[model samples]
Target chain A: MKADPKGVLTGEHYLDGDFACAEGALAAGCRFFAGYPITPSTEVAERFSERIPEVGGIFIQMEDEMASMNAILGASWGGVKTMTSTSGPGFSLMMENIGLGAMMEVPCVVVNVQRGGPSTGLPTMVGQADMMQARWGSHGDYEIIALSPNSPQECFYVAIEAFNLAEKYRVPVFIMMDECVGHMTEKVIIPPAEEIELYPRRLTNSPPAEYLPYMPEDDLVPSMIIAGQGYKIHTTGLTHDERGYPVMTAEAQEKLVHRLINKIRLNADHIIHIEEEDTEGAEVVVVSYGISSRVALAAIDEARAAGIRVGRLRLITVWPFPEKRIRELAPKVKAFVVPEINYGQMVLEVERCAAGQAKTILVSHGGGDVHNPQDILEAIKESIK
Target chain B: MEQSRTEIKITGFGGQGVILAAYIIGKAAALFDKKEATLTQSFGPEARGGACSAQMVISNSKVLYPYVKRPQILVCLSQEAYNKFEPELISGGLLIIEKDLVKPKPAENGIQLLAIPATRIAEELGRRMVLNIVTVGFFTAVADVVGEEAVRGAIKDSVPKGTEDLNLKAFERGFQYGKNLREHGE
Candidate 1:
């Protein structure tokens, strides 16, 4: 219930950027957090270190992000909610394991509070350049559920959703939050501990001898059996048969790959999230997410006051790229503007969705500064005309 | 078109509470008064002694974007901030400076100026910690961004356990200090 939230608001209690992320994870029922602290993202590890104990959970500061991700995979298999957070450079290092999680059908959340980068570009400055990489960073053909939260409150709920989607589909999820949002302070009211609807991992109850880790049945997500729970489970990155034995045959590979992709793809409607604003008859629609979307929404209201028919399509879940929704909204909206911290990263997806039905323009910025609303309002003015 | 939004920027050297000032003032306007406010900070490498700025947008409706290109209200806590931000304010906007740290500049045509003893007033309060809240008090006094009650609410909401007494006293003194500044010639 909506308690007074008297002493429970941890971010309100005083935390640096990294600790805010950790508290969000803990509040999201994250039973396991594993990672090595670098410079800026270290507080996340420290906070998780302190928090995991209180909830009867475990926190492990692994040797690296790869091990961190693998440990989370292991823990999630042990039937616990799992997550690991890293910065841009660490995120790059964890790419292979992210692929592993994708192939192994393991549900775990990974957060990248991004700093500047081609490689360790700026460990402290904020950057949204990782927008594209969050979707295609790991090698493979699989859909992802990447959420970008503009503030700490959204960060809390999005972490839960990241974990929820991960378990529901058995895949790795990304929290594509910038460092600014990670560190910023605000009056975020944490709902009472009882109000949280936390989704723990789904465990298999099949007999020990007959357990097949990859056996496809009713739900495309094959039930996962804990490693040491008296279950003979064989899991691998290579294509496996129903008995969980690695098979080099193309037929076995197709069935496995298709199941993995469709498990998420078939549920695209349920996974996609878009926050709409006064879009009924909008002529100019700005598609922005993360902290940048905060400005986009303000710009829309400002333009509307000036008699501009503006609206906003704020992506809460960016990866499954609200394609059908965008197409439906595109026919009615005359123009689409994407204002991101990076230059035209997400607009590419919006353009693909628009497909000439609507004019797509990029209101982009870079090097840590979010795009200003006036630039977007100017774009709206030009687009509507 | 009726303007319903106001974008302000607070820029200063490290440890000046630029970020905290933005939060208190923005929260004062948005959350407490039921308007919309968005707060953002510049990414700092030094984390100490480097130039830092906080951008805040205070509006009557929903705040979509938060970053500022041209500030309508620019408060400079150091000369570096003054030099960096003076050119960025829209012509005829308001500029406030710390008298001890920055030399006062008169408005050309559209811009207005204020010279405040914010650092001295905060120091006189027996806590140099209140400097950011002092600046926030000055912002409310000049721009009517939000009421004093809202600032207090923001303060209470932003401060953590055990530090409430210090922050609350700091905020009240800062509010009075700004009032005293406005009442006097400076």
Candidate 2:
């Protein structure tokens, strides 16, 4: 399906990443937004509030992050695509409700324009520290899709991809953007509506009397029915069955939880997106995502110029961790050098995937800013040694 | 001007449109001139009368590292901003200042300096808020970093709809002053 023309702002624009994310949401048919404005991410909510009215959508300023997360879930179930944006402290507050969204199998988008963390660390600085939290913070054994964008252009394009993934899989999708990408201004090109493709909501065709809200159709994902559509439904955070009733038994828990995990696990190949360069028979591979990927490219160029056989692996989609590719490269490369704004969040995943086959060198920082290219270049040099 | 990349810093007190000046230059280079530019700014809980600064990197290719370590061009609109950021200017770099506002300290060898009374020129245009626009105009003519017509198009695209004529006049005033300085071999 093509994007709605009313929501598309087709032109060449000079904008920051936060504003670009908001435009992406609008273009992707997200008609409902609920958020409490926070630094480094407030521009997204501001843009949404200013633009939503023009497109005949709802923009709610909730009192706090908890309410904001729950409001989006409710809006999504009420038959509209929904989203919310926040930074570190606010992101922490939304975790419990994010778990609720996952448990309920609701389709929604959460954007974290990350700042320095571990409790109000730096309100207005950059950080990629929340990479692990995006995967594991919400709770027990559930899977969600996450994307990392390096620039304003990717922030615009990847945000639409985030929404489409959510709609396709019926799970919450996260956009983990750091303050550097969120605040930095650059050129972004938004394509025309017909050029953009969107995934329409999967509505069940069964009559009201025959519909089962939690019943899956071979794909492990269930078709959804909006409230007030003459279909009776009951949804909750507690473990529920196909009829949407709370079932406290262990058997019910196993059945419900397994479906939640398998939906994403079965479709992992479709959800993961990676960009690779020069990985063929290389001695070292630099693994990075978001802004770090671009920074790593400079080091890669310098390393290649100095006669080092180094390759680049940039993760456009961070979660559902490209385990297969990493494992394949582990035995082939001498080492995987990971450079991130955070101390060592995603490096652990890379190390696990390598699994003693190759050395994993983590070029870690505490993240008020991005990595120095020379520091990464030094790590790449050490990897070859 | 034909280099791979150039780093620039623009600084002033809050409410002086320091960030806006950087945005205009970045837009002119990235959008209008079809170059690549990334603009980043400082954001924190500073005091009411705090120094505000914005950094930009303009390149023929993609910008990898966003922050400006040693700026090749520094534009200071206030004494405090000049004092705070002057030492970070690279040797042989260009330093631009508001002649009425900043009494700059003398610098090392091979430095090029351009001073303009941008606030006075903006006042002559009957609006003091366009001082940053005037500074941008001066930068376009003298810096040789971004194209002149590109910056003009950027100013028109960015400023408020009703105030385009006033802002363009302010730009013309600063550009003429810069052209005069170059013509007289100053």
Which number leads on lDDT? 2
lDDT of each: 0.77, 0.92
lDDT of 2 at A114: 93
Question: DockQ of each candidate's interface versus the true one?
Answer: 0.31, 0.65
Report clash pairs, candidate 2: none
Off by over 4 Å in 2: B1-3
Q: Write the residue-wise lDDT of candidate 2 on A1-385 in tens digits.
A: 9999999999999999999999999999999999999999999999999999899889999999999999999999999999999998999999999999999999999999999988998889899999888999987879999999999999999889999999999999999999999999999999999998999888999999999999998889999999987998999999999999999999999999999998988888989999999998899999999888888888889899899999989999998899999999999999999999888989999999999999999999898888999999999999888
Q: What is the C-alpha lDDT profile of model 1 across A1-385, one tens digit per residue?
A: 2212221343333333455666667776677888878644666778788766666678887998889988988888887778888888899889888888998888888888877677878787677889899889888776667998877667777876787788778889898888777766544555666666655556777888777788765768777877777887778887788877899998987888888888877888888877987777888888888878876766777788899888788898998888888898889988998888776788999999898999999987775566667898888888877
Candidate 1 is scored at a TM of 0.84
For residues B69-111, write the lDDT of model 2, one tens digit per residue: 8999999999999999998999999999999999987767678
